[model samples]
Structures are given as C-alpha cells and as structure tokens.
Target: MRHQTYGKLAVLAFALVLVSFVILGFTRAIVGFRTARLLAAPTTLLAASLVCLLFVRGLLAWSGLRPLE
Candidate 1:
C-alpha cells in the first residue's frame, strides 16, 4: 500500500505534463509561427512526451508492475 501513493503521484505528474503539452500546443496554434517560434521546435514537444512516458513507466513500477517480467 505504501507504493500506491507514489504511483498515484507519478500518474498525477504525468497528467500535469500532458496538460502543459496540450496548452503549449494550443498556444502555438493560436499565436502563429511569426512569434513564439521555439514552440515550433519538435524537440520541445518530444521532450514533454518523453517525460510523460517516463512518468508512466515509473508509475507502473510504483504500482507493482515488474516492467521486464
């Protein structure tokens, strides 16, 4: 049961990151490419995706799922 909290926290963090990614994407769409050009970089979005995925994997571990097994 101790790990459940960490698992939940990880999931919550992942959700937050996901929300931020969406918000950034939305802003990029609305603001146009003339300004805020950095948002257009694929790396920014890719990094967010990677972090979220890592959190998801960690969440699984914290929830007691053996990843390699």
Candidate 2:
C-alpha cells in the first residue's frame, strides 16, 4: 500500500513538473522573461526540491532500502 501510494505521488509530481516546464517555456517566449523572472524564485525552489527527491529515490534504490520498512 505504501509503495503504491508513493508511486502515485511520484507520477502526479512528474506530471505537474512537466506541465509547469511547458508553461514556463511558453510564457517566457511569448510574454517575456522580465515577467517570468517574477516566477523565478518559486520555480527554482520547486526544481531543487524535485532534484532532491530524485536523488533520494536513486539512493534508496541503490541501497535496496524500502522506505516504509
């Protein structure tokens, strides 16, 4: 159950990140980056958080550890 929950959460996060990246790219191109810069801080934080999550996932898999166990 925990594994399934984790998988679902990971998938949802991936989808949201993908959508945000697309939107950010389009907005920067059409609406200019000066406006986009207003979004930079939150976006950077999210990106860093995602990267950290990915790193932790990789580390767990490499160590053969089950998060709930």
Candidate 3:
C-alpha cells in the first residue's frame, strides 16, 4: 500500500518535472536568456523533486515493497 502510494507520488512528481521543463523551454525561447534563466529555477526544483521521489521509490522497492505489482 505504501509502495503504491509512493509510486503514484513519484509518477506525479515526474509529470510535474516534464510540465515545468516544457514551460521553462517555451519561456526561455519566447523571452530572453535572463528571463529564461529565472524561469529555470522552478524547472530545476521540479527536477530535484522528481529525483527525490524516484530515489524514495527505489528504496522502497529494495526493501521488498513492490509498488508496481
């Protein structure tokens, strides 16, 4: 149960990263380098969050918590 929840949360986090990356890319392209760099903050944050979630999920799986099963 916990593993499943964590898996879902990880997936959500990854989705957020994807969305943020797209937004950052578009903003950077449409705006200038300075503005794009500013927008990168959130995208970077989302990426970090996604990585954390994936790490957590991996730990859980290693502990015998099969979320995908």
Best by lDDT: 3
Clashing pairs in 1: none
Residues 2-69 of candidate 3 have per-residue lDDT tens digits of: 65776687778778777777877898879987887687777678778778867876777788776545
How many residue pairs collide in each prediction? 0, 0, 0
RMSD of each candidate relative to the true structure: 6.2, 3.2, 3.4
Q: What TM-score does model 2 achieve against the real structure?
A: 0.54
TM-scores for every candidate against the unseen true structure: 0.43, 0.54, 0.62
What local distance difference test score does each model get?
0.61, 0.66, 0.74
- Candidates 2 and 3 compared by lDDT, better number: 3
What is residue 68's positional error in candidate 2, in angstroms?
4.1
Q: Which stretches of candidate 1 lie over 4 Å from their true place?
A: 32-69
lDDT of model number 3 = 0.74
Task: Write model 2 residue lDDT over 3-68, tens digit each, in one string.
Answer: 676577567667666766776787798788877655554655676687677668757866878453
lDDT comparing candidate 1 with the true structure: 0.61
Runs in model 3 with CA error above 4 Å? 60-69
